[model samples]
Target: MLAKRINGALRHVPAWPLYIVAVVPPVWLLWQGLTGGLGVEPIKALEHELGELALQLLIAGLCITPLRRFAGVNLLRYRRAVGLIAFFYVVLHLLVWLVLDVQILSQIWADIIKRPYITVGMAAFVLLIPLAATSNNASIRKLGGKRWRQLHKLVYAAALLGGVHFLMLVKGFQIEPLIYLAIIVGLLALRLPLATGARQRA
Candidate 1:
């Protein structure tokens, strides 16, 4: 009953407001970086925060399917907004690395080629571009349901790559990155055919 009520209320809540709310953290991080509040390596701090935020948002979007299936909580309406917000942060993260950290175009290319984490991160970002571009009703209509869904499956790859990128970028067996990787793996496990089939038939 409580879930029903929450779902009903969500029907009236506009997704635009959520987008506005989602923009706050990145802006705040930027402001803090500009004001020396991000400690010694502000650029690195800002980049890390933006990438983490993107990962968090992607995980949140991934949760929508399981939430509706098991918890009776529906958030399908906000999934697109969540995804776009994730993509936006990803763009910011890449920009910071390219323009602020590396600055030199040749060095950026060299880093992407030499650094395994950067290569993985770039691949994940590249996968996300088509997904972000086709996230609309028009694209849905044009591509049809099955094809669109198949295309969006790129997200699973992106998520796994993102997790691996983060893990490798940390360069150690840090608990936090390990935890995030575990969560991503768990989420993927939940989406396996057996689990999804059982949930659907339930």
Candidate 2:
């Protein structure tokens, strides 16, 4: 069954494009950083870019199931890839802030502790770490389906936290983060009715 599924996924889409597409943004960032095209403060640009990418990827990951269900495309196969990429962006976001912006390890730790936005962002990223770690089929099988599903539900919290982080990160409360927040809420709300109905039936 697994082999058939793997073969079907490979036939459905080529993998190389996905990999290449994923690397494009970071490569661009590296080039910009080297060329000093990232404004007066390249570090700030790097931090902001990474955070935006993380948020964008988080939005994409949350949209996968809804898009699949609504469009009847069965693109859940791409969910893990989307999620892991999101996780990578988040790691980049945090690392740039820690290494470039904060410079001092103690300051970075203190910033995470003191700043509510950073605190939420770090929480979201930490939540993603486990999800990314268990993204592989082997880990999924080892954990069993039920446990795996439960663990993955952490994505909801991570998404919510990510949106909150962005909302707080903005210079002022902006519509962009609110829009992302609404989408996250709507996607999550879409799940509850069915789960509730199933329980009522049982």
Candidate 3:
């Protein structure tokens, strides 16, 4: 089967290399922004680019389980790397908004409170903090497997908020964000039966 072949090939691929490869996109994006390749509004373009990458990575993280359950492709080992990279992009997105886009320190909190999209984005970012902090093996051992799994479930909420944040932040009715939201929702739906099965087993 194709999946078996792919899985067989994946066995030789180390997850660590993904971390090294992940550095390329942000570096390229920053280079483009600096070179004015991002267009007239370079800062805004860079901010949006980082934010979109973050959302894409979040959606990728959500896809891992469904891909394994339905498609017979195991990415369990890469999930942590996927998640941490997503969180990395999320932090980069927030920093670009803070340091480059909005330099005013006082307005950061004000924007979070006043702007609906920013509020949603901040909420999603905050939820990821604990998950990112505990993505390590030591944290897993310390927290216990069950508790660690529970804590990581926060990604679902964060993913939902991330989709909504993108949807709301866009200037008008945009198909891209809507597509992203739909994919996120569909991925979440795929996990429902798995959760139910686990509950039944318990």
Give the clash count for each candidate.
0, 0, 0
Instruction: Find the 10 residues in a row with the least total lDDT in model 1.
Output: 193-202
Off by over 4 Å in 1: 198-202
lDDT of 1 by residue, 1-202 (tens): 9889999988888788888998899889989998999998999999999999999988898888888887899998999999999999999999998888889999899988999999999999999999999999999999998899899989989988999999998755689988888988888888888877864452
Please list the C-alpha lDDT of all candidates, in the order they appear: 0.91, 0.82, 0.91
TM-score of each: 0.95, 0.87, 0.95
What's the lDDT for residue 116 in model 1?
95
Q: Enumerate residue pairs that collide in model 3.
A: none
Point out the higher-scoring one by TM-score: 1 or 2.
1
lDDT of 2: 0.82
Steric clash pairs (candidate 1): none
Worst 10 residues of 3 by lDDT: 193-202
Across residues 1-202, which tens digit of lDDT does each residue of candidate 3 receive?
A: 9889989999988899889988999999999999989998899999999999999999999998878877899988899999999999999889999999999999998999999989999999999999999999999999999999889999999999999999997886789999999999988887786653665532
